[model samples]
Target: MNKQDYDIIVMGGGLAGCSSAIQLRSQGQRVLLLEQQRYPVHKLCGEFLSVEVISSFARLGILEAVRKAGAHPITRTYLTTSNGASLESELPGVGLGLSRYQLDLLLFQRAQELGADCLDGTKVNSVSGGLQQGFMVNTSQGNFSSRLVLGCHGKRSTLDLSRPFTGQYNPFVAFKGHYTGIALPGVIELHAFPGGYCGLSQIETGEINLCWIAHEKILNCKNSTLPDPLWQNPVLAARLHSMQCVRKSQHRLSQISFALKGKFDADVCMIGDSAGMITPFCGDGMAMALQSAEMAIPLVTGFLQGNLSERDLKRQYTSIWNREFRTRLQIGRLLHASFINAGIANLGVSLCDTFPALARGFIQATRGRDHGANLATSDI
Candidate 1:
């Protein structure tokens, strides 16, 4: 019944949306941050933030808060194959493991403190119009207008109807759960199996987060044990057979990767997995989600201030994202192809042992660090 407008309207209240809202509020912009779910809701995620992300957290003034909220520091990452061969590498900086439930709530609360209107249980139905002045958002609560809209709604949602373009739909499903008995590596650990890889890490509450991304076909055929036929390699099949006793808390499909385009195009900037997602094998997706908000803030702010146009904002955002993540995404894509290749996987591990620096570089790249870049190696 009432129409309240803000400088910007941010849909999805996860890490990226909250981060963007906080940044905008800090610049004295009026912002409305909406979330379909209430605070402290859990989502299926790896729960590990890489060192690159921790650095951003410190700069954003939330590192201390994250620790005080019970997040645990992880200093290293360990990777093991089904054949039992393993490689371990120290992160160039400290990483942390914390559930999305806690992390998102922390970010949301911070945004509220900074003056963003935080709306929970508000499901956005659709958005219509462009970036010049503002667009009308149709939600369950009615209509609202804002010049810029940000999508941070995670992997799957019905909001794609509001956009003009969508990318190819992937058919993979990601299942995640939290368990208590497993002693995760002091850092994030990845165990590769056929059809997919699983990330295991210890989160703040002393529980281990286990997440697996596999083909939907593999999941559908399994009766008791996960189906082996879907796995392209014998190594992945062997690993799945071994996880019989690991408990599960939640199971869901991570949406196929997609992005918004058209007149609705760059008018709305999508953040987090809503823009694009990376395989979780590297433990950098969530970090990239948060960091992307940081990178987009200045451009968005400038656009709002008339210092930059929508075209410039979109160009800048795309350029920064590509510069920062394109290579890593490409490398991840190459690695995904080998997960099912026994010869290549084995050869890869052998290579890591022969050239430790090269292995470190690969790990760094997986964590979204550019190759040959020098980032601080620390755990604080």
Candidate 2:
């Protein structure tokens, strides 16, 4: 009705939403980007981009921007067991470490420059769908209609709370913060602990971003309301405890209610953590999110142009996400599951140390360089 306010309305101003908005605007489509928070918002993220993400950034013409914005260049990743046995692997292209506060804002500004009508501090309360008119999105500010709606909201939100997907379970919780005292020698680190694992990397700002995910059982043992002492498991407690200036000490916690799955149709494609998410053990989550957009945008564009049927768009989007992410997430989940048993995790560490080639292969696989049908498949 009334020709709609925008062609596309993207909810959530994170990497996925901003990227999608930018891409769509670059192609001469009018996009409306809504973010619940203003620019420079912080999210609990690994802060380390894989080689595939770096490559995608280059393709999107944002690599130089990232460099100029002081994103750190990471050349390798090091993994250590609870016993301190370590394994290292080199990255094909340098990964960049930039926090969501900086990265998402930069992308949002880029989208604005490309003609996206960005609305910050705008909360999307609900969305109603129709086959003919598509979706009517309700927000705190006002209502907007769009030919398509995209959910880029983070891990869990009111949107998901109201939507009610079947058979969802609260799986695990994640904790992350930024610290300054920890010393990292230009390598990203994954240190294994009980229940789950912790990641450490020196972001471009010289701050170490420490993130962890663990089962609810482990988190319940600490007795304190805070996560610091709870996270002080014998495995990684010493290393993380030594760090100082832990600004933004609050953990971005969320239960893994569901695996990474895009439930919406072409008129409403979900992206990033809003779609299902995998375990962060493999360090490929960011890569998957950005690359998924590259696949979804063309189909979305085709649908908007009336060149592709809505059925075709839904089939194509779901097919592409399943192909690209389903298995990798499964593999990551299996790997993370095995870590529950310290013996298995220690053994994995031993294997990695025994064979540097194994470490290299792990790096390649996580970076999306290991070719397979999931990556090579066409958007049928």
Q: What lDDT does model 1 reach?
A: 0.72
User: How many residue-pair clashes does candidate 2 contain?
Assistant: 3
TM-score of each: 0.86, 0.90
Clash number for candidate 1 = 4
lDDT of 2 at 155: 70
lDDT digits (tens) for residues 93-137 of candidate 2: 556678877888888888888889999999999888754577799
RMSD of each: 4.0, 4.8
Candidate 1 residue-wise lDDT, 66-138, digit = tens: 8787787787877666555677877776678888878888889888988899998899988877786477888
lDDT, model 2, position 379: 14
What do the candidate models score in CA lDDT, each in turn? 0.72, 0.74
In model 2, the clashing pairs are: 260-276, 260-277, 261-276
Candidate 1 minimal-lDDT segment of 10 residues: 370-379
